[model samples]
Target chain A: MIQLEKIEKTYTAGTVQTPVLKGISFSIHAGEYVAIMGASGTGKSTLMHILGCLDKPTGGRYRLDDIDMVNLDDEALSHLRNGKIGFVFQQFHLLDRATALRNVMLPLIYAKEYPADAHQRAEKALTAVGLAERMSYKPNQLSGGQQQRVAIARALITDPAILLADEPTGNLDSKSGTEVMAIFQRLHRDGRTIILVTHDRNVADHARRVIVLKDGQVAEDRLVAQPRDAESELAAVVDEEVRP
Target chain B: MRTLRIAQEGARALAAHKLRTFFMMAGTIVGIAALTVIMAVGKGTEKKVMKRVNAFGTHAIMITAGGGKGFSPPQAGITTLRLEDAEAIRSQVQGIDVVAPFAVRRDSSTKAGSNQLQTIVMAVGADWHDAWEWYTTDGEPITAEDNSTMARVCLLGTLSASDLFGSQNAIGEDIQIGNVRFKVKGILEPRGTSPMGDEFDRRIVIPLTTGMRRVFNQDYITNIRVTVKDSRQIESIAKEIRQLLHERHHITPPRDDDFAIFSAADIAKMARGISGTLTYLLIALAGLSLLVGGIVLMNILLISVGERTKEIGLRRALGATQGDVFHQFLVESLSVTILGMVAGSVLGWVVSITLARLTQSPVVISWESFALAIGFALVVGVFFGVQPARRAAKLRPVDALR
Candidate 1:
């Protein structure tokens, strides 16, 4: 569960103050699949950073799982992030020198109580992402689509409370993008809470609800009557390629 | 366990880039190797100096009848030194223990039965044995009676006895010293080579009175050996003896005194020749290598930190504390230096053995060198590693991610 009350972020350089997020408020319950959409300069990145607990809002109260993150110190925030939130970056920032399995097991290295079955858990996560045969492969050895899948496996290995994806399909081809979307739809159906942040309308339409930001404020927040089905789109793409 | 895991990550990075790690370790290797060699050579030189000092007699000072720097064999034909000078030093000097005046013949042809050879022969008083701490191992020593009565008995050194008599016993046998036949009374104890690289075991000894009256026919002795009660006061007593000699001989500073005095301390200095300067130069080399090595290690680590900014951000986002990152970098640095220390120690050991074999000198390798090397490695590792670690830990996650 997450809650925001008038979250505001301002950057200061010398004597000049620049406000990035102005009086933004939102709430999302557990197991909810939602998308936050905005163009560049609409404070989309600033809000995403706050939501991921990477940075603090200058003026606001943000509660994730009943703990107000505003008062937590940097060290406590890191532990909180490890325990509650899993992140999938647009660049798929996996360690280049590490194997896919090692990348998935990275979060457990920083866990307060390292699990004894960490290796097995990483294997299962990688298998769930359709990378069972490529567990030992490095990032450079994987394609764009497979690298993204490895990043997803890494994100889910900790079994965090919420999954936050920032432009998860931005760097993939159309076919890989559809496949990634299908995986997300399947996760949503399995009662997992998902927060998808992107500027693409087509990407945001895959979620059950969408919130759009304009000029550092929420301009639209509504439920989609009929969300696009990514599984069928992937099947259609495969069929089109096979027919040729 | 957490720290171990983080340290493992640092080790993995080093393993990944082996050349970079080796470059970081180069300076430490050279510096520690030089340090180890210096310790070995220094300890070996000190041992040699002690041995030579002990051989020359720690409590004795020799006043040779010659005007020259450094210890040399008693200058032949310098007839100014006499038995009265030995008596004056014994009566006038405060710390005098025994004063024995002796004359030396460098090349004297001697014969025993059919064997004949040329060797040095010393004419000494009864106190010479106490003054040199030398005594006959197998037969009677020269006594005051022998010197007083001008006895015809003489002592043969171990080598000289073997040279003149072969396997047969030379004691109670007769030997000729420059056509003067004398009966051998004893075999002197074996003494090793002198500081001047002459064999002390290959010489003969006779009573001073007999030598002056019947043998060489010289009235003046060539050397006065003074043994002091306290070895610590030997240098000052030598100074006093010099002044007494200067006044007795009526010589001033402008006129070079026809005498030279040498103590055990001078022998030590002579034995340690050139090694002191060599040690100082090695110390400078060791210091410079360590200093420059530490600087190079620090600069490379700083550059590595800059290059790994993205990786740092990723680790931070994955819940690594700044302390974890700092610990990782510090571990990386310490590993390089510590590993280099081990390699350098082995290299130094090989070089030390080669030096000992090639130069035929003692090279002592002790545990202290290894301990000191570890100390230096840890110091350089920690000193150079902190700044790069701090810089890495200070990077903000958000900014670093961008």
Candidate 2:
């Protein structure tokens, strides 16, 4: 579960004042699948960064599982990011020198636990992403979709409470994107909390609830009438686009 | 497990840039080598000088008689030091081992079928051989009976025997000295050259009574050679001998004492001082070279840090702590220095042996010098490595990742 009240983020770029996030508030409960949608410069990515504890809010309070995030030091924040939340980036930031298995073992390395079972758990995570045979392949050796799968496996290796994916399918083709969305839908079905960020309406539509941002403010927060399977929903959207 | 993983990652990163790592290491290796060579040269030269000093003989004293003052025409006086004075020193000095009196005169040229050489003939008493630690190569030395009877026998130095007899047996052969014939009773061994480059094995020796009665007809000796029991007591023993000579001469207040005593220990001390100075100079030169090597190491390491900035950033983003980054760079620097130390040690030994052979000087490779050189090189590595490591550690992970 995550909660934020009147969060603001301002960055100073050499004497000029830039406000990326201004007075934004939101909440998400456990086991809920939510997608945040916004146009460029609407602070969705900034909000997601704050929610993932990669960056802190300039003003206001954030609570994750009743623990205040703003009061934690940098090391403690990193610990929270490692132990409680798993992150998947749009660019699939897997370490280039490491194999998929090694990449997935990174969180456990930082947490300093499950050292003996790290390899086994990493293998299991890769298998869950349908990448068991490609565990020895480096990031550069894998396809774009396979690299994203490796990144997702790395995020899920720690079995964190919430999986925060920032535009996870943005770099993949439609078919590979559909497969990634199907994995996310399956994880949601397995009762894992998922917060995804995207500008694509079809990707947002696959979530149980969609929160849209306009001009640094939430424009809509509503549950979908019916949640379709990610593959069929993607096909339906493609069909509608062809008709138009 | 975490530490092992971090170390493995560090090694992998270093392996990725082999050329840079080698270049950085070159600085340390060359520096250590220079230090090793310098230390070897210093120690080798010191040993050579000490050996030369020791060859002059320890705990011995030389008393030369000449140049007295307070006379109307500078008093070209014959200060005839008698056998009585030598006996007085032997009886009165507490640490006296042996006292031998001798007189020298340039006698004559000896010829053997066309080749002739001028030689100094020295007449020595019975204790002279033991006092000077002389050894014979052929025949036998003059005995106490020969000295007392003033026998007309002489010992030819190695060069004298070779020149007169052309490597043939020279014992019992006759040679002309100032129109006087003296038989060669023994041949002296080759004693090598002195510091003044004089061939000591070129002279001739005879009984003191023979030189006084048959050759020079002089009744007194020119010098007295005194051997002491121990080198540590030479200063006091020399003083005792001086006092005894003053009493025998009956000189009041002993102004100049009519003689100058030279202690072999003093000469050894002087030689040691010179050796110390030379060693210091060599160490300084080596230090300068090491300093240059250190600067080279620092320059290369700084350049490496700049070149590997992106790799450093990547490692940091991969969860490397600041201390990890610091240690990684430090290890690279240390490896360079250690390699240089090994190479330098070998190089120093080679150089020392070559110098010893070429100059015919003793080369002493001291373990202390080797350890000091290697230790100095390690210090240089740490001294030059810390700056770059700190700079790398202070780089922010986010900025580096970006």
Candidate 3:
């Protein structure tokens, strides 16, 4: 669960003050699938950064699971980022030198939790994302689709309560984008909370709730019907019936 | 465990860049080599000088008569050093071992067949053998009976025999010294040349009575040589000898006494002073080389830090502590220095040995110098390595990543 009240963020570029996020308020409950959509420079990414605890809000109250995140120090914030939240970026920023399995193990290394079983858990996460066969391959050796799958696996390896993806399908082809959406759909059905930021309406359609932003303010919030479970529908296929 | 993993990673990275590592170690090698060679030369020169000083004989004191002021008329045809003075010194000085009176007559050439050679003929009492521990290679040394009888016999030095006989045995041979024939009794062993390049084994020895009665026909002697029981007591013994000689010569207040006392200990001290100065100069020169090597290390490390910025950024993003980065660089520098030290030590020893052989000088390597050279290199490594390591450690992860 996450909450933000009137969060304001400002940037100083050579003595000139620029405001990115102004008086934005939002909340997401556990196991909820939410999508935040905005055009370029709408502060959607900045909001996502604040929500993930990667950056601090200049003026506001930010609480995650009733704990005040705004009051935590840098070290404590890093701990929270490592232990409570998993991130997936648009470009799938996996370490270039490590194998897919090793990239998944990075968060566990930072948290110092389940160190002895990290390899096993990483393998299981790779299998969950249908990447068990490519676990030993580095990011450069994988395709755009496979690389995104590895990033998703890394996000799920820590078993964090919330998954935050920033433009997860921005760099993928249509087919790979559909596959990535299917994986997200499955993760949501498994009772994990997910918040996805995108500028594409098609990507927003996969979520149960959509929030649109304009000029650093939330313009619309609506509940939409959940997309079909594409993987399970394919799994339910049967041979041609006699009447057909 | 984390440190170990990081160190291993650092090692792998260093190994990947072999040329850079080799270049880093080159400076250290040259520095250590120069230090080792300098120290070896200093130690070897010290030993050679000390050996030369000890060659004059330990605990032996020489008392020479000085030319006094014009007011004190010179004793014409008189020898102030007499048997009485030798007796008094032997009887009064508690630590005196032996005392002998010596007189010398300069002879420019001695004729042996067709060849002529310069020589110094010294007449010494029989106790000279006991006082100086002179050994003969052939016949026996001159005895007390020979002194009493004034025998017409002489001892030839190694060089003197070689000049007279041309490699032939000269034990029973005769040589003419100032129109008088004296039979050669023994040949002395060759003592190497002095610091002044004077050949010590180029003189002849004869009985004191023979030289005075047969050759010069004078009853006076030139100087007295006194040997003490122990080298440590030479100073006290020399003082005693000077006091006794002063009293025997009947000089009051002893204003610039009739004799000057010289001890081997004094010569040894002088030699030590010269060698000490040389050693200091060499150590300073070696220190300069080490300084240069340290500068080279600093330059190379700075360049390396700049070139490896991306690698450092990657490591930081992987959760490495700043202290870990510092240690990695420090270890790399130290490894280079240590490797260079070992190579330099071996090189220095070879150089010292080759120099000793070529120059015919004694080369003595001391353990203390070896240890000091190594320690200096390590200190230089640490001293010059810290700045670069600090620079690498202080780089911010965000800035470096960008």
Docking outcome class, model 3: incorrect
Best by lDDT: 1
DockQ, all candidates in order: 0.72, 0.18, 0.11
lDDT (10s digit) by residue, model 3, range A1-244: 7888998989889999989888888888999999999998998988887887766889889999787989986556656766678778786777666789977876665554446888999999999989989999989999998999998988887788789888999999866777888899889989999999999998888888999988888889888876555454334442222236
Rank order (by TM-score, best first): 1, 2, 3
Decide which is better by lDDT, 1 or 3: 1
Sort the predicted structures by lDDT, highest score first: 1, 3, 2
Give the docking tier of candidate 1.
Answer: medium
User: Residue B335 of model 3: what lDDT?
Assistant: 71
lDDT of 1 by residue, B61-153 (tens): 999998899688877788899889888888888978899999898899999978987999999899999999999998899989999999988
Full candidate order by DockQ, most accurate first: 1, 2, 3
Using TM-score as the yardstick, the better of models 2 and 3 is 2
Across B1-402, the per-residue lDDT of candidate 2 in tens digits comes to: 666555555566556667766766565555555566656666676665666556566767877665342111111235547778888887777878889888876535656556587876778987888988987877989899998787878898898888778878888778776667778888887877653355677888888988888877767777888988888898889888887887887766735566667677666565555657766776676677677777777887788777667556544543455676788777766666676777777877787778778978566778886788678778987988789888887776445543
For model 1, the superposed segments whose C-alpha errors exceed 4 Å read: none
Clashing pairs in 3: none
Q: How far is each candidate from the true structure, as Cα RMSD in Å?
A: 2.1, 7.3, 8.6
